[model samples]
Target chain A: MSEHILETQNLTKEFKGFVAVSNVNLSVKTGHIHALIGPNGAGKSTVFNLVTRFLTATTGKILFEGRDITTTKPADIARLGMVRSFQISAVFPHMSVRENVRVALQRATGSAYHFWKSATSLNELNARADDLLEQVGLLSHADALTVELPYGRKRALELATTLALDPRLMLLDEPTQGMGHEDVGRITDLIRKVSANRTILMVEHNLSVVSRLCDRITVLQRGAVLTEGNYEQVSADPQVRAAYLGGSHAA
Target chain B: MTKIQARNRLYLLLVAIVIGLLAPLVVYPVFLMKILCFALFACAFNLLLGFTGLLSFGHAAFFGGAAYVTGHALSVWGLPFELGILAGTLAATVMGAIVGKLAIRRQGIYFAMVTLALAQLIYFLCLQAPFTGGENGQQGIPRGFALGILDLSNNTTLYYVVLVIFSLGFGLVYRVINSPFGQVLKAVRENEPRAISLGYDTDRVKLTAFIVSSALAGLAGATKAVVFQLASLTDVHWHMSGEVVLMTLLGGVGTLIGPVVGAGVVVTLQNTLSSGPLNAYVPVVLGGIFVVCVLAFRRGIVGEIKALIKQSF
Candidate 1:
């Protein structure tokens, strides 16, 4: 097995006696695209939240880079090089597309606290932000406010902002939940390009994307791990097909 | 901003400075100073409410609290003019740090209530505090020498001093809202979770904004105390806080020129109505303006104008 960059031990979350996530263990390799998949209310999003420290685990531990970070604040996790993205596009709506990536890059440089200096002085970060936008195929929309971007492009911008952190491991919560087939292809390629150097853990509903992009898959049912395997092994499994794929046979 | 837009803004700034320089010659110097002080106060309030999405209801505590501190320092302690303003501003900064530390623990309306409660506490303390002179307040404060050179006893000299300070404070506010730190604070305002995920300690940013805003508000109040030569209980009253909010809302909460225009209009209305037969209806008229602004022009005066300009250009 390759080295595990992120691992969870009995990660459980409960809300008012409703166990959103229960006794689930997961591991993500250092240089692989791992996926978490489940049916609706399978606690897939909850698992993402738990690992990112957005929600405290009712009873469990999250380990990143071999350090137990179950209690680390959400901001601290990002600083530790484990950053996450929201399921919905979360760009700064009123700011320009270029500015969104610039702000993220500024945060990475520990200069987000420089109020005395003008923001125009941050032109030094423009080339890098431009490069990130180019990576996401948003170089043409740099000057446009994010509110004006099309849905697919907004998601691309969100990805660009995430990329600005140069994170060691990235947690993407439904990176392409709402997108056209063409946009999905674009984002899949983009993800493939970006994932060459870092680990990515994503929760996706599109099984095809999972099959093509993910090296390993973890299936969750009712807040617990049902199975773990490669796409072929997991898709061919009778239990996973009935519980998740609605008994539909995989190609 | 584009080159054309930047040049236009610079032109506007020059025009405003010229107008301010010549304003006292036409209008009463005391009245002009009153408007300038309140304008500065509103801008400071906007730093939190407009830019940071923090609505602090206890700003009167800083405005009036600093007035009292400066009034006492000048009248009772016999300090120089500049030193007294500095003392008062420092006191407000400390208050901002303490109150911000407590209030930032809660957000939205809860944050507003926390600030209001703290301001109320300060109001009571001022009422009972000997230095504040209770209900009568500290009166007849001398206009001490500025820099031990220029005598502020002259109204025109003091008016120019107040104008320069207001200009500096306004410029600083403009600089801050356009700074990188300010951009992060805007990010915090737009989406707290997104800002946190980007590795910004949002609470610390909010606290710093609160302190800077408080200090500037105190500067305005200190100048007012120096101008009027008195610090009254009315300054610290909750009504004063509400008035500043109204001024900001009417001017344009987020627009740079909004508060200044709002202050001028409100101050002019007060001066025009308070002495005339409409004295009893002054509050009613101001209330009417608030209703009209909220119902039809939610962006306030300057924001509406800015939108129009954007459309036209």
Candidate 2:
């Protein structure tokens, strides 16, 4: 837990001759907020997909917690204590907020297959589920259907569900995408609060949030790491500025 | 489930039980029994399509496969009623596991196609198999006694037995849909990727549900064979599969009681109409009703009613 929680060695992915993520080496240390930042089409999502096994790597290896997971299934990767949250705040929309958390908690009760027992039996986990909801400041909306929740609230519920898994490492894909300034500030604080005793690897576009939250930052350009350092060093890197400015109209 | 929702379902069940117990005095027990069998069939199908969002087009394989097994068990093996139904259910469970394993690998319409194709293979096997009696089907399956005690030869007695089986099957469906397992099933239905990311082996979850639903469907089929003492090609036919889907949709797809209500209406119409002057137009009429139901309210009868009740509150 004190060393690297996730390591990818010369990882590469290609779609029929077009390289999407290429020869990238990434090592995320434990108990820290590690940010993967690049401009659009920088293969951030591709590397995530490769490590999570959503797509097979063209070449190279991935190791999580000292075990090779290059060929593992996505669910197995998660089961191995590397849970991922989607960019869009993936959740069971029709279920209540509490129910969403409970779904993740069901596996831990060791009775996820008990179809004969009443669901009320799962009420034992209600307190724990509520605590998760409370941790994310969503206790008041526990009974509300997830689809009925406002956009920001849905993101919080997603975090609660992710926390319910309590993985050793959490992969968040754009956890604060498409949010207002106030919502982003609130979520940044929430993520910081939840990062204790666990590793968080995030692919984020918002640099201010990254500099504010991440302990270490990896900058990618064209599917390969351009620089890896603290926020100040990465921000001061001339290549990082050129990649960002030339790649976008922001300048 | 919430206390209020559970109580509401309990009340609804009570009402249905009263009707089931007393209706035989006025209605022909055989007709009522047919309705019960199809109702159970529809309910089993709903567990997959309604609850789990899997649309299977080959359910008749399970239904009719169990019927043939039950028929053989009672007639050839001379087993008791309970054992015969259990044999049939076991056969369907095996079938479900195999079919689910293969079919669930594909998704959506491909899943439907896989089941349909596999069912057709089973249908052909039934037609060619020596024990199945080919076109004649397995016939004269004795109702036999329940545990060698009560006489199943009596229509009323058999009707009550069928009622018990239906109740058990329905209750099992209810418990499963409200169980911890059911939550994961719904989660998979709602968002499969999210479920997968949560460390759920979704294929396994889906397969388990398929087996349960198939076993229940087989139970209905076996019971029907016992009640009528016959298992025919019609039982395994694609039309039978289509008919169950119609029943589920006409009533309500996802609602617990929707399939039952749908089966009752469909069976009643098929009975009263096909046996009367409107027999030739029975299919047309049923088709028309299905069209109207889809167009006017795609949620079906029970779903629409539930929506209205929710709206009022």
Candidate 3:
């Protein structure tokens, strides 16, 4: 296996003459929890979107496990073991909490196309969903509507659903974006637990979480990587501090 | 589903069967059949609108287009009753595939408009088409003998057949909504981007939903033509499309029996008012009910009842 799970070379995304992500080269090492940090409008999220194929790269090549996936469709990328999470906790609001994870598990079985069969027949997946829910500490809320969950719990549900994919490279866009202090701590621990045998490329605004959890941190400034290093080196760099000096995400 | 809910559904099913069996004895058979046809149409339309979150405003094309084909097959081609209905259904399914392909390219209000435009195209085609006999439509369509034995010429026999077909269609729709595919569809409806991230081909799923809705609507249309012994311009009219939407919304957008109940009420209202002095006010009454539904009871009758029951429990 290659040292890197994913690599984006000269990735660029231009929206109507405005360059959102400019000539960015990013790589995530295998089994490493990597953090992409940047101020608002720094284009960290844009990089995530480009790598996941949610938005087409204006120019560049994205390699996953040494295979080019630059032109692949967004929906097809998940099947290739690179799954992404939305900045918002994107659970099916009307569905039961259990069903949210169950839908993700169904992706593994490829039974999402079976309309004639009873959804109950997929009861076999319920145990796995329960296990996933338990892992995210959402076992108690399994039967409740996802929409009814508190903000923190909903993010937990989103994590469970993402973990259901068992992805080789998990791309989480601001995993704990709108979370409270307790939620941030809980999700940081959850991310550490889930990242044991997988690669994680996370766009996080919280510097504390990044320093604690991420093996490597890449800071973006004005749509390009300003600095890339271990958390200690990146945080200690005077240039990195200067870039974040006036920003709200300063450490 | 919970045990209580399952039990309640069973009770509802038993009651529905009892009512279906005896409805002709009390109500006019033709009128009841009309309600049944529209009920099935609304249910099919609901499958798209409620479950898939696709608002198709051109459903009249499938419903009326199928009626025209079935009428043509039975009247001009002299096909068996079953074959004619199948012909109509297949035609509608094919039409759905074509129209759904185009409509699924857009979403939300645009999707609705595309379907509406396609249905209008079909309407114009039917108007000028020789098989449809222009505005007069294909009339005097022989009901024919079903299965070469059961004489559908008898209104009583026809009613039972229509009932059975409606039951099967409704049951199939119910099964579909409760299926794994249906769950995925609901996910798509709730959040398409999330569903795509889960590796679902949301477009394909939407198209499949559109086709299923169209086929069922066609089945209803074919049955309606045979029951009325005529396929006319009224069946294909844009107003008919609006009527099905009204029925589904009034009954309950996502509820299983909402469309059926809505259809019954609307058809009965039209029937009752057609001969009375209130005929001119029927549209106004329906419009008022729709306004009330949107403003006061956004979930429709069945949806409100469901919420009420859940609260009480």
Candidate 4:
């Protein structure tokens, strides 16, 4: 309804006396692939956590689709259509790959609260679950135990499960972190493919992936925004260059 | 479940049924009923530990608490056995709701601590309560007629009754773990934060599981009261709580049938070693087996055997 899908106004979070995310205002436009880029300890994940209500903001207002959700419970916020992924692959490791996706789709079947009903009642979710898996190239591994999947494949499976939610806004924290080069590229491409129709806000370390996939970038330094622009504009900014060099040195 | 998996489970259940029918013939009926009662207790405990990932150390409160309630209802009020057990189950359910509400506010060791502390309180209450008969226990509890006709006085008749109750509890657990709700519980166990981000109300899920486990445990205890015609402080003791944990862990915490096997082994070992030259070493043998289970057979006997089979194929 608003120009921005998600807007955080003067958000700030502090632990004890230390500030993790300083006063920050971020607006993610609808249907845009927005990237929050920062070095380690720049509070990127903290922002994601705060936005998802995993952590309470010391001071701020978060608006999702123009609705004030700064005080909403985390689970309620998620059900309100804003879902997040963890820095690590979020999954049910003991279940099969398809079953992992089915967890998200199971809510649609209205039997998530029915313990007496057989799990086979979820058969209706299978076609969609497999379709999501195929989208992430995990269809062949549908029957494999989630824990047994290779690391890269596990990340792919995370994407499939997230997609199963069909969320209005997807907050992915470091979707390609701890991956090999091929995996990073494939994940970057997968993100691009899935970015249609929905809005996305991601925290990524790889600048090339950011440049290739993200429509807009917000560079953060010391828990504050350093600069914001399109890739070329950000790449040409001198302060952005110094921050990257400083960030790398700090890393 | 897949077709092959369902068939395998069916075969397993059939085998259990066959064993239940024949074990009383080869073994003492009273001893076999004891095994069945404990097996149901262990399985009910497993629903929380293995499936839901909640380790409730105060389960003795539910198991023993129901025994006292059933004992009072039957001996003092002359209620039917079915209603007496039902009353006991309802009491446990109410206790579970209250305990679960408070305990789920914490997690892991803290959760276990809350349950343990509460169960210990229940033990003291049982010790001091006049109606419970204190140290003497509620002895001479009449084994009344079942469903108004079948005489439960016969050991063989009672064995079948006990078997039926165990089957009902086991079947309910199996059905629950394979249901959609069970999937959420496992997801909570596997990754609680992720489940939250996925919009599942984990607290409610956990509370429901706690209540179910408690009610089934109470059912087992009420039946035990009828079998032994006694309810004692021992049922609510911290030792009883610890015993169920040992059974669950030894049988394999997460495996459905593992707890039953674990309960059988422990009950049989205690029975066999109670009177012989090894009478003084019952605790030693049980502790030794528990250590071995934690060390090499970490999945418990059934879990390890199942894993071995899976790996072989």
Candidate 5:
């Protein structure tokens, strides 16, 4: 078995009287694309939140790189080379695409507190940001303010920013939540290209995208894991079909 | 060098500084000092409000608290003017750390309220503190020369001193906002969750901005105490806090030159109004300006100008 980059054993989350995510086990191997697919309110995002330390798990162990990081702070978790993109676009609207990428690069490289040095003077940092922007296909729009970009481009910028962190694991919460068909296709391709190096655990609602991109699939329903396998095996499972696929097993 | 933008901001700043230095020769030295002092104060407040997006309502605590400390040191202990100001600034920095730690726990309006309430508590403390001299305040503070070489009793020397300090404070504020740390603060302001996910501890960033802002406000207040040769209850009052906010807002909350312009307008208005028969209505006029600015001109003067320039471009 390949070494798991992230593992959660008996992970659970409770909100007031209700359990949002219950007694779930998740294992994401290194350098593979794992997709968490679920219906609305199925706690897929909550699992992402728990792993990223945005929301604490009520009970469980989260092992990152073979050590327990269950109660680590979000920033610390990010610093340890795990970063997440938001469900909605979270680019700095007033800043240019280049500026947004530069900020991320500065933060990741531990130079965010370089008071005497001007941001523009950091030649290497600027170059890195430029390269990432090019990779995300935002080179032409680098000078444009983020708010001026279309929805798909903003999502691409978010990916570029996440890439700046040099993330060992990338947690994407609906990377293509609001994209049209062409945009979705572009992002799906981008994700595949990105997953060539880093481990990607994404929460995807689009079944076709999930089946297309995910190397392994985890189906979640009512805050619990329904089933888990490769796309073919999980889609063929009768319980998964009844509860999640709605009696469809075309795959 | 991008042709130095032809505007040559550095040249502009030098010209402005030269104009400021020559002001006392053409106008009243006292009035010039007041403008310079308040300009520094506004710049300090702008560091937090504009750059960090953390609006502090207890800035008067630093401004007035430093005044009280500097005044006491000058009058009672007979400390040198520079030493007294240093002591005052140190006091404010300490107060700022305490208040910043508490206020940064809550964001937006809650942070504002917590700072205001904490400042009010400091005001009460000053009112009861023996050295503060109560409502009478500490008066007749000595404005000694620089290292006992320059005579602050001379108006020109004093004006030049104030001018240099104001320029330094203004330059510091400008430098901070343009730095990488400042970019991070902007990132935090624009999208905090994104900042956090990028490995930034935003609470720490906010706290650092708050402390730096408070310390600078204290520095301005200490300078003002020496300029006026007195520290009064007016420095610590909540009204003073409101005035700083008005200055920053009227100038342009996030723009570099906005607070300075705002300070000039407010100080000039107050100076003019004080000599006129409408002196008592100054507060009403200030209140009106605030309301009008918030409603009709949300961008303020500098912001409006920048927008126009960008549109023309």
Candidate 6:
């Protein structure tokens, strides 16, 4: 069996005259938390966009579970057990938290066209949504409108919704981008808990978060991989230090 | 079970229907039927604009196309009432599919424009078609018996028949808006991108809503042709489309009961004003109402009342 859940060979993306991500090779092993860390304009989000089928790769191939999915639509890719969470909080703001999760569950469970059945009567769907919300510690706010929740709570809701898709691979873009340290710690813990049975490929700017959560880290500079190893190994490497981390740390 | 808040709503509707049925005995049955027809038309329009967040300017296609079909079927081919209505509805469904396929390619203001242009094209087609009697329209349509038993030629019997069909159509609209599909439509209106990311094919949902709305509009139009015993070019005119829109907006855009109330108000206003010398100014009044509704009362009358109720509760 293939160890890689997702693999990209020489993936490249260009917008007009600028190359956002160039000549990148990335592989995420099943049940591993792989973090991609870099400064601004490192094309981390661009790489995510390409992999998720939101943006077509200018050149190269993407393989998921050893099957090529380079030409699949985003929704089709998502249905095939790979889901992504946006960098900015994305949620149905007017819907109650429970409804948001139920919609996703409905999509996952193949009931998208059952119009006559009252959504409230779908006790199984509600129970499943409740369970996922409880997992994210958001069960208390289940009936609250999504717009009313705090920012961190909104992020938690996004995770619950994504989890409702029953994905085998999860792509997270800056999960804790604007969170306070305490909230960051809680979210990091949540990510760790979710990473147990799923492959997680995350683009994180916060070095401490990458150090704490990642099993292996890949450093990128100018859209190319500068180095890849465990945090200590990549952090101390002379070439990675010069290109990305800067010489002060190595000196 | 939980105090049945909708019971009061049921009671109000029952009272209104009773009064409507009794109106012809005291006033005029033909006029009452016309009002009921317009009321149903506005309700159907509201299903798309208020609940689904789609503003269809081509509703005239459904309404007018059904009128022409129902009129021709009743007067020329001599079909029964129910079959005529069904034929009319099928015609609208076909038109809905064609227009929906094209209109859904755009969003917001462009959506309105695309539907409007399509409706205008239909209006011209109706003008040129031989069966429609061209500019003169088909007149003297027979109000045949319901299932060949109800004797719809009798003014009282025909009035009741129209009343029942209108009530059923309105009830179905209410039921659809309260369904899960309706909630998803609201979610799409509130945020399209979020709904898409949540795995909904938003385009499919919108298309379904559009077809349903058009079919119901056809139902209303067919009933009107039977009641008035005429189907004229006026039914398909762009002004008729604007009138239904105005009714929905004045009553309340998103509220379930607003469109019915708006339909009643506009029909009543037009009837009363037509008898006086000021009849020519009805369009100006409608224009003013639209401007006022947009500028000062974006929520419409029903939305305002609901807000007040929420505050009081």
The CA lDDT of each predicted structure is: 0.92, 0.92, 0.92, 0.91, 0.90, 0.86
Pairs in clash, predicted candidate 1: none
- Write model 2 residue lDDT over B1-313, tens digit each, in one string: 6799879878977898899999899999999999999999999999999999999999999999999999999899988788989999999999999999999999999999999999999999999999999999988888889868899888998889889999999999999999999999999999998999999988989999999999999999999998888998899999999999999999999999899999999999998898899999998999999899889989999999989999999
Q: How does each model score on TM-score?
A: 0.97, 0.97, 0.98, 0.97, 0.96, 0.90
Indicate the residue-level lDDT of A177 in model 3.
Answer: 85
Q: B1-313 in candidate 1: lDDT tens per residue?
A: 8999899999998999899999889989999999999999999999999999999999999999999999999988899999999988999899999999999999999999999999999999999998899989999988889989889989889999999899999998998999998889888888888888988888898999999999999999999999999998888999889999999999999889899999999999999999999999998999999999999999999999999988997
Winner of 3 and 5 under TM-score: 3
Model 2 quality (TM-score): 0.97
Q: Model 2 residue A218 lDDT?
A: 95
- For candidate 1, the share of real interface contacts preserved is 0.75
lDDT, candidate 1, at A111: 73
lDDT of 2 by residue, A1-251 (tens): 43999999999998988888889999999898999999899999998888999889999999998899989988888888999988887989999999999999987777778999988898999999999999999999999999999898899999999999999899999989999888899999999999998999999999889989999999998888999999999888888888875634542
What fraction of the correct interface contacts does each predicted structure contain?
0.75, 0.84, 0.89, 0.85, 0.87, 0.27
- Among the numbered candidates, top DockQ falls to 3
lDDT of 5 at A226: 88
| Per-residue C-alpha lDDT of model 4 across residues B61-156, encoded as one tens digit per residue | 999999999999999999998999999889999999999999999999999999999888888889999989999999888889999999999999
How would you encode candidate 3's per-residue C-alpha lDDT over B97-171 as one tens digit per residue?
A: 999999998979999999999999999999998889897888889988988999988888889999999999999
Colliding residue pairs in candidate 5? none
**Residue B93, model 6: Cα distance from true site in angstroms:** 0.8
What docking grade does candidate 5 earn? Answer: medium
How do the residues A1-251 of candidate 3 rate in per-residue lDDT, one tens digit apiece? 89999999999899999988888899899999999997799998899888888899999999999999999988899989999999988999999999999999997797887888999888999999999999999999899999999998988899899899999999999988888899999999999999988999999988899988999999999898899999889888888887865633455
Q: What are the per-residue Cα lDDT tens digits for candidate 4 across A90-192?
A: 9899999998999988866667769899888887889999999999999999999999998889999988888888998999999999999999989999999
Off by over 4 Å in 6: A14-18, A37-42, A218-229, A233-251, B1-27
> lDDT tens digits, residues A1-251, model 1?
23899999999999999999999999999999999999999999999999988899999888998999999989899999988999888889988999999989998677777878888988899999999999998999999998999999999999999999999999899988999999999989899999988999999998888988999999999999999999988988899999997887553
